[model samples]
Target: MIRTERIDLEPAFVLHSRRYRETSLLIEAFGHDSGRLAVVARGALRPKSRMRGLLQPFIPLLISWRGRGELATLTAAEAQGEIVPTQGSATLIGFYVNELLLHFLHRHDPEPDLFETYRRTLQRIALEEDPEPSLRIFEKRLLQATGYALQLEREAKSGARIVPDARYIYRPDSGPEPWDPRRHSGAGISGETLLALSEERLSKRDTLREAKQLMRRVIFAHSGEKTLISRNLWRRRRSSDAA
Candidate 1:
């Protein structure tokens, strides 16, 4: 006889959750070993249910579940520790991370390292004044985890190490090619910026801006026509501020 797989007290975070039936809930949770999985939170909506408080997004949780099919039954859940209070833009960025994972990661595929990266990113988001660096790093890592990382270290055709002074056009499929100066304005990236990003450095304004643009383009290409709703909202908010 085969035994059903049961996960007990696994480290996880709720990505999204919705009402299921009258009192239960359907939760999309990201588990350290399970990647992403669908879970049913039975009777979580009842007034006295303890799971109700523990099932929220942005909170670190230890959850127990058992299942043999697509949706697992959530047997227990509790806070691993105190939530590091993500509010304002941090919360939005948190949602953005969730949506990205939901869009790219396959269900039940284990990504333990990426899961740790995500947990760190969330922790930083709660404390950082500027959340872009965290978001960008997570975005790049997400692409890499899903097999679409941009080549930022060297020229694609010449195979030469990227010079810090040279300019380049980031081609999605082919990587960064040296850009022609006479043909275009200073819209392409500077080698210094690319190198900075390669080293996970985002202090300078120019480096941050260029890296954001490049990463956004790569994400859009792989997104398969799905508009990142949070990204659109962010742009609109920026545009309105400018206006």
Candidate 2:
């Protein structure tokens, strides 16, 4: 007989959800301790179901589950507090963050610090007009938590500290190296941006721009051929606005 795993009142966020069978909902939850897992909410689609508007991405929730296999049954869900909705551009950024978690995290691997980072990121995005800084920071922390941390203050070669006035070319796997236009093919980033990102102090226009470019490249390099749907949607929206 298989022993069932059980968890009760675990702090979690609904990363994604979909219709399941006739009256249930399939949810992908990111628990503070259990990490990413799938749980089916039976009869969630019924007209008077208690979880009608409670199972949504970005909401703080306390969830319970039990199962002997990969997919567990969602036994209960309760909101932790008042819902603070992510609105406007933050919504897209929120989806982007969720997509990163979905792509990078392995099922059943729990990083409590990373969970807190994710929660803080959502709160920051909801409050800030320019959520790019939070997004960049989240990418950096995610990389660090998942064993792909970037070396921002040190050179890939020569073991030298980065100088703010100089320019460097960053390679995702190899870290940053002093830029030599004669040999380097990728874009050159200023040392200022690197240091700012290293310290998570991105603010200036140039620093933010370069940080965005660097983080995007590194994330894509690590993610392989998987394309982010939120990014594609944002790009399409930009193109439409321009047209």
Give the best candidate by lDDT.
2
Which pairs clash inside model 2? none
Off by over 4 Å in 1: 1-3, 181-186, 239-243
RMSD, one per candidate, in order = 1.8, 1.3
lDDT of 1 by residue, 65-106 (tens): 999878999999999988858887777788889999999999
Counting only residues 3 or more apart in sequence or on different chains, how many pairs clash (N, Cα, C under 3 Å) in candidate 2?
A: 0
What TM-score against the true fold does each predicted structure earn? 0.93, 0.96
Kindly list the per-residue Cα lDDT of model 2 for residues 84-185, writing each as its tens digit: 579877888898999999889988999899999999999989998788888899999999999899999999988799999999999899999999989988
Model 2: lowest-lDDT 10 consecutive positions: 81-90
lDDT for 4 in candidate 1 is 76
